[model samples]
Target: MSELVAAEDVLLFVNAAVTATGQREFRSSAEEQRFSLGFLHEYVRVNYRPVYAAALALDVNHHNAALIVEGLLRTAGEAGGAEEKRAEGRLIAARLAMLPPQRVYRLFRALRAAGVNNRRTRAIVRGWLAARPDPALDAVKYRTGVKAAVRHVHGRPADPETGDFLFAPGRRVRYGNALLDAYRRAHYEQSAVYELPFTVAEGFAAKHGVPRAVFLERIAPRMTRLERLRTERASGAGAELAVMPLTRLALYVLALPFGERVGRRAELTGALRASARRAAGPYAGSWGRVTAVLDDSFSSSGSAVKRRRPLAVALGCHFLLEALAAPGAYTALWTSGGDDPLMVRPYGPTPLGTRILDALETEPERLVIVSDGWDNAPPGLAGEVLRVWRSRLDPGRGTSVVHLNPVYDADGFDVRRLAASVPTAGMRDAEDLAALVEIAQFAEGRTGFTELRAYLDRRVEHFLTEAGA
Candidate 1:
């Protein structure tokens, strides 16, 4: 519906038809590819081609005047419509043909070596080289080198080693593997998680037994770390010591070829689907009042009773750094970082969050729930605990909560009404470190850790005796 896509919609359709027509004809490979390029230029417009072309042409630098053509092409042996696939082959050739002879020779040689050498493909490369005023051999070389690096040497220059073809074994495997490594370095996983927070949340849920919402809340504190270095650089953070995103780490690890690695995606996916099922329906979030109502109906003593404690779960940012910083402390129940099969809900809440909560409620006396709101747990577990406590606890039951910043209460809470008023001095006196130290000593003497510890000890004894401990 947006202007950009809407404007190009019909063009893509027309281009597809032309591409089909070009494939059916038996013109030389070069001519077929040129026809395809012309059709595509008309279809997507010359402007769009240069977006990618300009990227290539910048060092061959003529900003707007550079006439470049671009389009996708099938590599040597990929499955596709015969005509369509043939046209794609020609398209690559046309793009290449526009380059200078040396560049054309190099590109053509590389492609041929990779086994993509149809006449149309060679001509396409030649034509593109022709349109450019300057020959960008370095650019061509660099691109080729990258292709070679991935073993997609489909168009890469030959290596001096065994004289064996590099990427010829598997084009998809070669290109895909290269793309995976490149994308990983560029840190693309962050974008993937942002695009699929719910999915990631589910992963956490199943792995950690935490509900999605609670997991999100626990991860809230760390969200600021997600600030992009690119944005910071623009704002003058400087190029040095720039922080790349954690999402990239997550994405790279997730995208690894699973066939060779984890091989257990189907099972993980089923667990995620099952977790999703339980949290569905109208009573989905009603666990709050459900606990309170159960508590009230079951016990009149308002004291020690066998009951389940609410689950508290936290989910942190991309787990890489955190895992590295404190590996043994964490119970990594599962990891999808390497060649493991891709989990359908790889980005979801830690499933253990809920499991932990279930355990807490089943044995309230055995565990004490303590967590920093900023720490990560599986999703939705924290909120579950809060809900249960608020609804079911005795009026006298109290909890000490910490708020990181005052901004948390800014949303029309009328904080002043609930807080005790404190007076500000009309005049300020500068108190150096020594004065502050003296004041602290006075305050400590009056009421400090010593008194507080005694009070806590007395309370602990009372509570223990009442419970027959």
Candidate 2:
């Protein structure tokens, strides 16, 4: 991968992991675990300084953040240069001081394990502890133990008095104030904070009295990309924002509210085509004819948080694949009813099997389907259609069918497949779209865990080299 591509992937992974809120459960399936472990290991190992900063800046889960700090401290201790070692120690200490008391306690053991026995390191920890002592946290630790305190912090149960801690002396006070101010502005000024299922942050912009442009410039940087995109669209300010890079632009346009998209459809379509053309320049003639079956069903709009939906993900992939395919060789089949597939919106029910059968008529060399895999259409027709297409349509059966799912079905599966012979993969985000071709190989059983690890190692090396570390 190019340095730019590697950097983008790294940013995407960090954003996805760090900005995940408590309400969101990190997937622990074998595949997800492997991916997470590999990515975290490589990230910390390659770019310890910035990764540690991100963990603190994003205020990720205490345990995950502690792990990054531990890794950085360990690397710092092993460093041969005295200046670099001291600099790393100071950096870690500065970040640690800003974290909550509970998070600091969680890092205690890990710090010890990382050989934080030096005087400078120990003093930093002690100074931070003394400056921001939490009596409640101390009492909890005294009564139940360190583990219990850690659990309490992570659980984040409603503590009416805990609101005072927002202004209490601590490194988090500034961040806490910013959060409180934002919420206050969002609630009182805008009257927008509602308990809705599919609401986005932009839904509150009007009530908060903050223009969409200002929100994007001032507040959106602190948010995850998913949150920012959804909010921008919900505020009906998507078009007013500056044009994004190809992948992000595709997702942004895809997430725009239907009402807001009325007259600007043609302009947005042109932007997508332009983005695709630019993205396709690197590997001009490397791709063959491609057909994509996109599922924009009602379920694609479901979310754990009232944020962006999978529909945006599916649409981004559709445009990305279209751009990457050979000229006049790409076809998009929107499962949602429409005269023009590109103009179809996400709604109605999923018809996976029917769409594949329809796409087979075109006899494209490659097929990519984006969906949540909750096919509610009558009988599961995807498998039967795949069998038919292989048996009758192509004697060589060279057509590659890839099923990409955005949501992780916690029922013990990552990808839901239509046929055993076909490949199914997970499309975690827009960055992963760049690896669509490689992921398809995983579905076909051509790649395994070894290859995945090697890929991660290569990325790590590239990132580190790019950083001149």
Best by TM-score: 2
The C-alpha stretches of model 1 lying farther than 4 A from their native spots are 1-86, 89-110, 132-134, 137-469
At residue 242, what lDDT does model 2 achieve?
A: 29
Predicted candidate 1 versus true structure: per-residue lDDT over 140-180, tens digit per residue: 22344333323432233333111112323322322223322
- What TM-score would candidate 1 get against the native? 0.18
- Predicted candidate 2 versus true structure: per-residue lDDT over 153-242, tens digit per residue: 332223323333322324232223333334434445543233111223456765556665665554543454455555765454444222
Report the number of the highest-lDDT candidate.
2
